[model samples]
Target chain A: MQTPASFEYERATSVEGAIASLQRLGSGARIIAGGHSLLPMMKLRLANPEHLIDINDLAELSYIREQGDELSIGALTRHVELEKSELLARHFPLFRDAENVIADPVVRNRGTIGGSLCQADAAEDLSAVCSAVKAKAVIRGAGGERVVGMEDFHIGPYVTAVGEGEMLTEVRIPLRPGGGSAHEKVERRAGDWAIAAASAAVWIEGGKIADVGVALGAVGPTTIHLSRAEELLRGKAPSEGLFAQAGEIASADCSPSADGRGPIDYKRHLASVLTTRALSRATARALHQEA
Target chain B: MHVSISVNGEQVSREIEPRQLLVHFIRETPDLTGTHWGCDTSNCGACVVQMDGQPVKSCTILAAMCEGHEIRTVESLEVDGQLDPIQMGFHEQHALQCGFCTPGMLMTARALLDENPNPTDLEIRTAISGGICRCTGYKNIVSAVRWAAEYEAAAKQEV
Candidate 1:
């Protein structure tokens, strides 16, 4: 296992206390929420830090609530709970569907939504889904608190817009009336990371598309939002022609690397196929709800 | 740093290095070797333990972070020398060969059945996905968990 050169761990009871401890630890300090992604990467010596400021005790960061027309999910909510949440299922069944494709039950129990977003792994299912859903991340730091769009949160592989000494506290997703969504991914196995994935959500108003979002995963440095594809389907009735065109656009837009998992061309092909499948499934759900 | 936590129905407090992992601390400090170390990393659930009644990879958590928490390892699965049903099921099914993975397997099974006594085949597969067993193709392992679930259910119904 990879061992840190040297490090310190502080268990902070409050958000302010955690921020203060992080400031004291200085440049090499990083907050550890669930540690599902960070600890594994640390063990591989891929990313090493000098200190880990534990923030699991901040119980305030583990809630899922409906506020007005949006759903605010705390960063510390475990994937298992997210999957089992009756409220999320009632309002946003997409999230529950997305949670099913995550790593595994053990990982779902330990992995936090914030940890996954902050890690910004291209192969991550939730990060891609967040972008497709246009979720906003609430981040807190020494300076203050601010909301960042999911598309802007990711800078590149293993990187995010979360600045130094900042922590993502919660994710805010807008609730659309009469909307439907789906997330689908192609993976080597049940518990393995996705080779490619897609998430699609559409808002149906008066038998026409009011909004559509499509995001791709594991095919680039970061998840790609197909704005051009979404634009093609906006205000149009759901149809195979539009989805197929968007799928083609998504395949063309992705810039995946050839790794041990598969060839670059294969991943690109899978991206198109999965995107098409996801959009098709999402569109059917939308129509079904309307009927 | 000094840390105090409950383990297997008992309270334990000790001073440990800040960098010590919970798994290492449990094995070295408290001398509870029941939680085996297969892959010192979190991929292999061999170091799995119950923290506050939820299954977590002990190797990933820092010992200092476990202060004031409740921890339960595979060693606590028995009652007065009577093996836990999961353990007995493993024995009856011959679920282990080298036995390196038994402790972790038993702990994972206990946690799964605790939450879901009657898990579907898919749920059972997902529950044990984090754990790795180089021995027997997991056929007997799955059978053992299913058997324990049935055994526990039947016992509950009798009472």
Candidate 2:
């Protein structure tokens, strides 16, 4: 009874072939990866793309490597791989933290990182994780590929900067010294969407917070980037007082709505508390105090 | 469209609509009703099956997408007249009451034991986190998986 509407399906043998099919199929076609998120929407008739370009066979797009000063992750990499990647854990433990709670292991075995980021669900974990790490998204179209930062990549709730006839190919995270990141999420139950989550990345230099990114999920239309909190934490000494102040800024700036998850005030409070906790953990890891 | 997939190690060719899910394909094509379909959505793990050695929710995958891939269902768990160790563990531990969540739980537990021969209580719970049993028979399920793990280890040692 929950089957999707009738549609045409084709498997893409290569990246170029997939791009070509996307160009030929036009806007009515959507790329299917993992199909964990998209299929559910399609079953509800919420998403009715007439043509599906299956990218599961595109093994070329599945990778995780350090390209110079950045860690480049292929779009087709499954959540399970990301959760267990020793490289990601070493560089950005936040990825493993978020992936651990993203969804159940069975779903994680099938869901891809590209699919999760492209879905751009407000309550999703990866969006906040990427935003906090200041990751750049690579979107490839018929013309060429364009790279967009997380700030520009997320346009709105369930909407991304990926245009028609275009597909997101990779997520690139810059590698910086003295950098550590952490993600904290609270869900009502196991494998549930975040009631309120905060992702924080802190880079320390000369014992001062050189740069930091704080983002909140499920508390707004898009992943809320705490620019004010980042600005406050930057150039400040890594101290509990400064993190508390940053948490205050998060509570003040984030816009959360009331729903089945909780009341607006509760979410706003979580934004502050979780942000503080994430910053503390990130700082601890940055200083080489905890693993 | 005409799609051919290896279900339970047997090639099954069928003409299925593009919208047909992999779960329905298995249940209808080979009549492997042992893989239960529940919650049509992917939240419930009742539709889980081994796709190329990985346990994936069948309801979320399109039959067309699984073309040419190896799919193993609950029916493949038994060899000859002997039930798989996992099946026997479930029976010995009373892992199910209503038996609705049994197939998915078994397949999920099987996949976990394959990857990690030894899993802690927390790990077993985490592996089957995707599965939901209204009977809330999780305690026995964990014990059953442990029982199977011990049985497999002992059998391997005997050889």
Candidate 3:
């Protein structure tokens, strides 16, 4: 039987209360939102925090809304909500696409977006989706709040910009005009982690690509933000040829190690193929050619 | 720590370690052994239960986190010895082989039907995608959920 080591549990009623407890408990404390990722790690003895500050009761931190020009998603928002949010679907269908394939419905009901991002697993789909959408992380500490871009939010494997005495409060994706996003993943079976997944977002203006974001998951230590591919796609007209070239970049760029999912060559091949598919679908949606 | 949780509409309180998982708590505290504990990694759905009316894998949830929440186990599906329509459907459709995956499958399907009275075959398959049934190859399980949906719809019309 697998079980976590004995630890003190504290339930936080408010965000401030949770932060205060985090500060007091210092590095020994960990904030558990959905407990899906954290509890599993705890059971394996991979994560052994001395104290767990439960934030599940902070209902105030659960929301997804349009705040001015950006979409603000509360950190405590569950995966089920992300998958079902029509507002999100209207803006970024990639969320729903990725959520559909990320684990199963029952797990989605209990898993939170905040926890998923914080877990910082390389195979996690949301990190790639967030990176592709240029989402910003809003981290709250006792001093104040600081916003970090997706590139900086993830520092290493299973590591994030969320400091020891802080917590991720919200994720803000800048709403740009003429933008469409899609996520594509290939997994071995239902509810399995991606062998290689790609998330692409394209903003078109006057039949030309104004801006683009492309990222790959499960093919690297952290989300592989395809800056080279984005640079190549920028200012170029959307075409099969341009996307094919971008796929080549993805194949050459990602750093994947062989494991149960696939070998290095297979994952690299998937990275390329999935990136092209995502880019094609995203562009089609941007031109209002596809739903 | 002392944890108090509502299991099948009954409040059960017990003194346990903070790290005790909900699956063990449900079985050992209220002695509701119907909720099986399968994969400790949360991959297997044998440990599924309803928390606040939504299905969650009990093996990964700490009992301490469920202190104030309402948890419904497989034992609740049969009240006054009258099986839930889902159970009846399972029996009629022969949805079980080893019976190990039945409890979790029933709870997961029950939650899905509660939220969606009539789900398509694709929807039923998607709803129970988390569960792994080594027996029956899921053909009869899908039929069982469909049968339950039809049964409930017919019952509603008769009423």
Best lDDT among the predictions, by candidate number: 3
lDDT of 1 by residue, A80-161 (tens): 8899999887666668878987876776778899999999988888888898888999989888899999888988888888
Tens digits of lDDT, candidate 3, A133-184: 9999999999999999999999999999999899999999999999999999
Better of 1 and 3 by lDDT: 3
**On DockQ, who's better, 2 or 3?**
2
DockQ of 1: 0.63
Give the CAPRI rating of model 3: high
Candidate 2 Cα lDDT to native = 0.93
Top-TM-score structure, candidate number: 3
Ordered by TM-score, highest first, the candidates read: 3, 2, 1
A3-26 per-residue lDDT for model 2 (tens digits): 999899999998888889989999
TM-score of each: 0.95, 0.99, 0.99
Question: Which parts of model 1 have CA positions greater than 4 angstroms off?
Answer: A289-291
Model 2 residue A19 CA deviation (Å) reads 1.3
The model with the greater lDDT, 1 or 2, is 2
CAPRI accuracy category, model 1: medium
Q: RMSD for all candidates, in order, please.
A: 1.9, 0.9, 0.7
TM-score of model 2 relative to the true fold?
A: 0.99
In order, how many clashes per candidate? 0, 0, 0
Higher-ranked by TM-score: 1 or 2? 2
CAPRI grade, predicted model 2: high
